[model samples]
Target: MKNRKPLVIGNLTARIPVIQGGMGVGISLSSLAGSVAACGGVGVISTAQIGWREADFCKNPLEANFRAMKKEILKARQISEGKGILGVNIMVATQHYKEYVKEAVKNGVDLIISGAGLPVDLPGLVQGSKTKIAPIISSLKSAKVLCKMWDRKYQTAPDLVVIEGPKAGGHLGFSREELETIDELGYDEVIRSVVKLVREYADKYKKKIPVAVAGGIFKSEDLDHALELGADGVQLGTRFVTTKECDASMEYKQSYLDARQEDVCIVQSPVGMPGRAIQNEFVQRVQREKLPIRRCHHCIVTCSPKEIPYCITDALVNAVEGNTKEGLLFCGANVWRCDRIETVAEIMEEFQ
Candidate 1:
């Protein structure tokens, strides 16, 4: 087959079909997103607790998030030198989702890739803005739901669609039982189904909606697999972690370089979702004990302070700060595949 081409999403096209998946709690910020965008890929910055570095982050996390969101996107645009697409990843499960969308649109982000929950009202939020909107779905049912809902309620279709399978990192969309039967569910089959839906909806709305598959896509062959399954592109998370421009600390990057196959596993997120991550000391301890929540940052509305396993915010902050043993090392299912640190340009060459 011929080589895969650039991904066309709405009015923006990425020379590289790879979209650098957004990582949170300090990962995949200005440095990582900007470098990836400069390499002709769609670079995504995660707005999940992005303001942890601000001076009054703990006291006013939401305010810090709003301030940092604009700053990070502006920085990414500058780094790309206006050559590549810069996008933001906002979670539907995040508190004040509309505000986050407003911040990105106000800053003129080229795209907004939202996940962690179905963004039904996303179209209304970006109604008058030029920011292209995309939703991250893990199943064909969710894809149909979003497409049908957006069409009927907002008279618009998604600019792009991201099919994030169970193998992706962070908050997953599948249930624990479904995650176990993912292989039986046949990932290729699911991707093809979503691809079909994207094409169908795109035709119905008289627009083009590109489909991208995420999770366990670490190598060129993996991209080929998704494309062959009818996906126009792929989104990767773990591979970008070891990149030199990654915003994660050296110790954090080292953990990726040093990870073994057995070290990567499916851990339960405090948000009540199953996520892939590196098995660390803190993860193990949290699994065995119910830790207390000191201060609720009002992250996810569904997260009950006393009911969850541990405080995800605190654990992730520890990881962001380079405290490996005490942090939650969220990573993709292909975490073990990352063996060395390379520049963003060099890593992009691997796909070429």
Candidate 2:
């Protein structure tokens, strides 16, 4: 692989094109994100039900979540010596979703990477803020939709686009049948297609929309291949979990260390989305029981807590709080490769 420096993504140049994948429900908070940014990569904090631990989280949702967002951003800024461009990953499906995006902007986030749903109106939410917006896309069609929506409505194109393949961690865009299809979609093919689409969109706008790819990327060869395919950068999430700077509990980290390739499976989430996760006892039980999940009228508007089988917020919080045995263990396909915990610097060195 050629030794090329990482490319920047937003209006302001990033020293490295690496974007820290946002993990949520307490994982990938300020400490981890700040460390990644300080090391010259784009650090990202996951805002998925982020304030589950606040004392008043149940009573005053906005106040608690807002406070957490501010605190975490402030903490990351301090750790980055005020130079790291801190970004937040906010799922468009969340309840009070717009509020979270607005709060992140109010707290001076450098960028917002939204996923889980098509954020057709995200550009409007970040109107005057310098916070760049990058929507996660699973296919070229999704990319086209997002670009068209943003251009027509907001008169602006996305600063960047993240092409997340099926092999990625957490939630996925494909269905169980699609994921289990006889012919699997090749990353190389997907990358080429998406890159071509992004380039075309960029040409029309007369601006470069930095293209980044994510999911199942773990080795130097993967990075090199992505760069060669026209992707300006890469986003990685699971690999960082094993890093020492990750804020997840030791047990949460250990789960990754102990995982085997077969342990990772695409389980059904109560939100009606398919997700990648370690097949632990919790997953087995959910599958076996087909639990009548009722969406707890708490987070994310699209979810009908009453009809959902489990509470996503509670499950993630349990894992973050160290109850991994009974909690949902979301992971990327390469999670099995983790064997030891190292610092962010050490992890980044491996890529270099």
Candidate 3:
């Protein structure tokens, strides 16, 4: 009913309640994030291996990422021209997660949305800064647990809460078995439960904790459905991939455009998680046989160089750089629906 309402997280506000889901390894960076922010939506930069393009990335990954993170944030601010909200998505499973959070806070990022694990210490990390914090949750159980933990530990509540359903792209919160029977799982009910749970905490903490739903949200009806389900906003990743300002190479966007329903499948990530992605030569190869890890970028905390099937960072970089055959193409369940490349403004207009 209130689909046109702004998404307000503490003092930060976006003109539209649409938060562009952050994609990794160069997918959502300065260009994409800035463009989305400029269009009045909350634009998020994925800090996963964000420094891949830096000259000393391989030699010094963390330093490279830190340097690149600041640069990207600054560039995104310039592109946004003071419109909308700019946030960064940092996975709790990432190595040196605290450092990434500190760097983003140091740069005065408007918000930090974290997931892949419960970010219990997030509030403590941004204690003195004006940077708002939110956690990505899929179920009411996780929502209650995180809210309780953050409240007990730091006496603070999240500024925003994002519910990432099974249909989302990249590494998911649901298990492989759960994802297999996702349609039968009735995720909308879970969304409602989380919204109610967050409202309870919002009352206790005396602040608004807006809930946003992610996954399979592509059309106007989808946005309406989320708002009707009591969500304050929607976070979308797949639809943005085909946008003109997306940071990924043209070939990467083409993969989404060329995708058929059957072309999308779930794969096991080397980080010991199940992920949704486009089925390709590389995906098939990884499923059947183990690909040797040439070098470790020290990206994920759970990834073992000797045991993992493939280097996730390397695969993602390949895809983002246009080497589709050898790259991993992460996508959403509705990736097949993306038929054309549009501008960020055009995409934002649809939600408006």
Candidate 4:
């Protein structure tokens, strides 16, 4: 194994250069995030419908989410015991996106990773806070646009940047058509281009903007590949799902253990984006016909309850709760490679 350097962003540092990507809808919560952080890696909690289990969630989802977000951040801090980094992943498309950012900042999270859309106002949102901001982008074009906009608007650059490719899980940045022919996309070249562009901006701004690559980053070899491509770190989501400390139910983890390469497929999410997931009964049924939307959780900004196929929140909640038959199991392209459950410490040790 090669010696790896720590991941540094502003004043914060992670002993390991691996970030546990944020999985949503009760999947990656305090338990998972805190565990990873304790292991000297950046552990991220997804703020997507994070308050699903709160008693007031059904009636006052936003308030419930705000309260839960604060509690989760505090709990993760306690669990981390002052080690590594704790960050929150807030989707730009989520309802009350600004409020969620404020809540995360107010809770004093170490970092904020935003995606699912370009988080153009993120710099302004976290202006005076010690919380670092990173944007999740898919292409060089988007990266250039974001850097230019942030530099021009706020006189600042991203503290870190995450490049999430087509193989990533849940609410991807690519079009459905583009994802279908992803084999011909030459995404590695894109990664290199984005890395080079970010380096230029880093030089111009006179600061370090560490770049991390997400999607299909499953093992130690994959981490080496990303570093070889000029990335400072790797962000992994699916690889952590089967971890013993992950917040998802045992049955949800089993879905990954049972998955085969052929079982992974792309699906159109109600959030108006393409996502990669294990093709289960619920996914197949949605592809065949539109399922009923019992009620809207008001999760995302683009979701239209009456016309959409099904509620993403409901499906994800089901998956986290162990209803594999009906839940939407969002996973990375390499999920099939997962064979067993391990602790966060064990997974972090592999990167070392």
Candidate 5:
């Protein structure tokens, strides 16, 4: 592993190849991101309803998000002290997806890791900036499609390709039926195939596209396994949740630390995708009744207040703020294994 070298995406480099996968609605903001970057890892902040904690977020959700994104990026850079990578995770399914990328690039972000949907046109948005693009893919088919689209349309390939497996948190790339058979699909086998699939494109385009694997990655052994399977790096999300620098409240952090293996399960998200989360009282309530969304934040174009269940924005914010009973506690499949809270530096040491 010592001979593997650091993660290099375009001009930016991370001393450690672990990217702290972005957790949103206030999780993994400046505090967490900055600490990870300063520790020589790529730090990512999720832009999903990023400004929910802001005072004026409800009235003008879009405007508030733009302002908060700028602030978080600058704060993370300051924390990094110009070391490692400062990146943002903006979902392609976001209502104003292009605007988020333009704003992040405008503020001189180091990287944009787009997922939750295919980001075929991401390159065009960051054309003039130093920011690099990495599209998250789950299967060999998606990987080939993304590479082909980018190559034909922009004459380019991804600077980095992130392979997210089924055991991931938040919204998943797989369908509900597929989530049930995660073990049958075999995560290790899937990663190896996708890595092999992308290598051809990397060689053909004459680019050293670093392939990173995300999902259920916990410690040093997990990191080794991903590398052993042919990935250049591993993206750590659930492990970061218990860190002191994590932006979520103490209760939120404790939830991960307190979770048991049985406590975690796949639940349906309002965005029409299945997600892994803690099976808490909040989750049970959502399943029992259709809690109406009183108002719309206009976050995702496909969402509506009058038609959907509860407002994901409200639920996630509640979770971030420590309202355990009513909060939507999104987590990875391995989150229940968390035993204690540690610093970002301490956790990064495991991978080192």
Candidate 6:
């Protein structure tokens, strides 16, 4: 195939194999994602409460969310000069899950990467759109089941597969007990396992399924190591959070700057998934129950108001708004090393 020229694996086209990990709550918006895509990498916009600023969100969630999603995609596409691929990361647990994916497809999003849940119906959602669909998985078993199910039901395979290890930020893949038991565990084994399974499916279907690995990958060496170990590409999330182009507040960005190695700890999310985040006053307050879920945003579907300790949406929004004292700050394991803010070019240069 003559190397395939490193075109975008999903629906978009990029000059390089690097795919920007999607951040949310206005973090990886049009400005940041467009710039990265324009720079020759796949730029991803997070569809996580992206319409948060829309005045009609609270009153008319679906209409407002759809509108904002369309606007963001168009904005990102325009800013990228129509170069590179513009993709979206939509969590499966969010309210109106299929609606969000459909909205992205309707808006001409190039690709959709879903996580935080199985997203079993992902293929069905993008049935007629030209958008490519990829589900994020953590293990070989999960990948096999999803691919098998998609193949059987939709006669389609994942355009790409993202194997996120336990060290990733936000919602986690395993139980707290499991994550703790394997703390600091290298991802090579899991990556190889998932890649092996993906290869089997690829061979059977006579298609190429490029495997991308994530979680705790920070520097050029880390990327090189993954590539050497069979990863076709890499997904970097936490490292980009500190970039000046990131839409996060200065306080939030500074939190990463002030973080220590020990400060990055695994904590329980209000949605019941184990997550890695910076140990800050907000995290401590949640651990101590000093801060409570004052208002209900009804963001995630799996969360029960009584069982969940707090409303994740409100907490995260608070952090994006710069209320570090009581906000929820989600980050990957390498967040502690962020010491300063720089441009995406500088961040990407480090990997070069």
Which candidate achieves the best lDDT against the true structure? 3
What are the clashing pairs of model 6?
none
Q: lDDT of all predictions, in order shown?
A: 0.88, 0.83, 0.93, 0.92, 0.89, 0.80
- What is the per-residue lDDT of model 2 for residues 104-222, given as tens digits with 9 covering 90 to 100? 99988999999998999899999978889899988777887888888788778888889888779998877788778724346578778878877877788788788888988876677
TM-score winner between candidates 2 and 3: 3
Question: Candidate 2: which stretches are off by over 4 Å?
Answer: 1-3, 182-185, 290-297
Question: Cα miss at 126, model 3 (Å)?
Answer: 0.4
Q: Each candidate: RMSD to true structure?
A: 1.5, 1.9, 1.2, 1.2, 1.3, 2.6
lDDT of 5 at 61: 93
User: Model 6 — TM-score against the truth?
Assistant: 0.94
Task: Encode model 6's per-residue lDDT on 1-352: one tens digit a residue.
Answer: 1132454474356665667888877778887888778777778999888878899777775677678888888888888898777899999999889888888888888889999988899999998779988899998789988998988998878888998888788778988887777744455777888888888878877778888788887876777777777878778888888887887888888888888889888888877788887788778877777446565555788888877777777778888878877778889888887877778777555554
lDDT score at residue 307, model 4, on the 0-100 scale: 81
Which model, 2 or 4, shows the larger TM-score?
4
lDDT-based ranking, best first? 3, 4, 5, 1, 2, 6
Error of 6 at 3 (Å): 12
The estimated TM-scores of all candidates read 0.97, 0.95, 0.98, 0.98, 0.97, 0.94
Question: Which portions of model 5 miss their true places by more than 4 Å?
Answer: 1-4
> Lowest-lDDT window of 10 residues in candidate 5?
1-10
Candidate 3 positional error at 102, Å: 0.2
Which residue pairs show collisions in model 4? none
Query: Per-residue lDDT for 333 in model 5?
Result: 89
Tens digit of per-residue lDDT, candidate 4, span 124-145: 9998899999999999999999
Name model 1 segments beyond 4 Å from true.
1-3
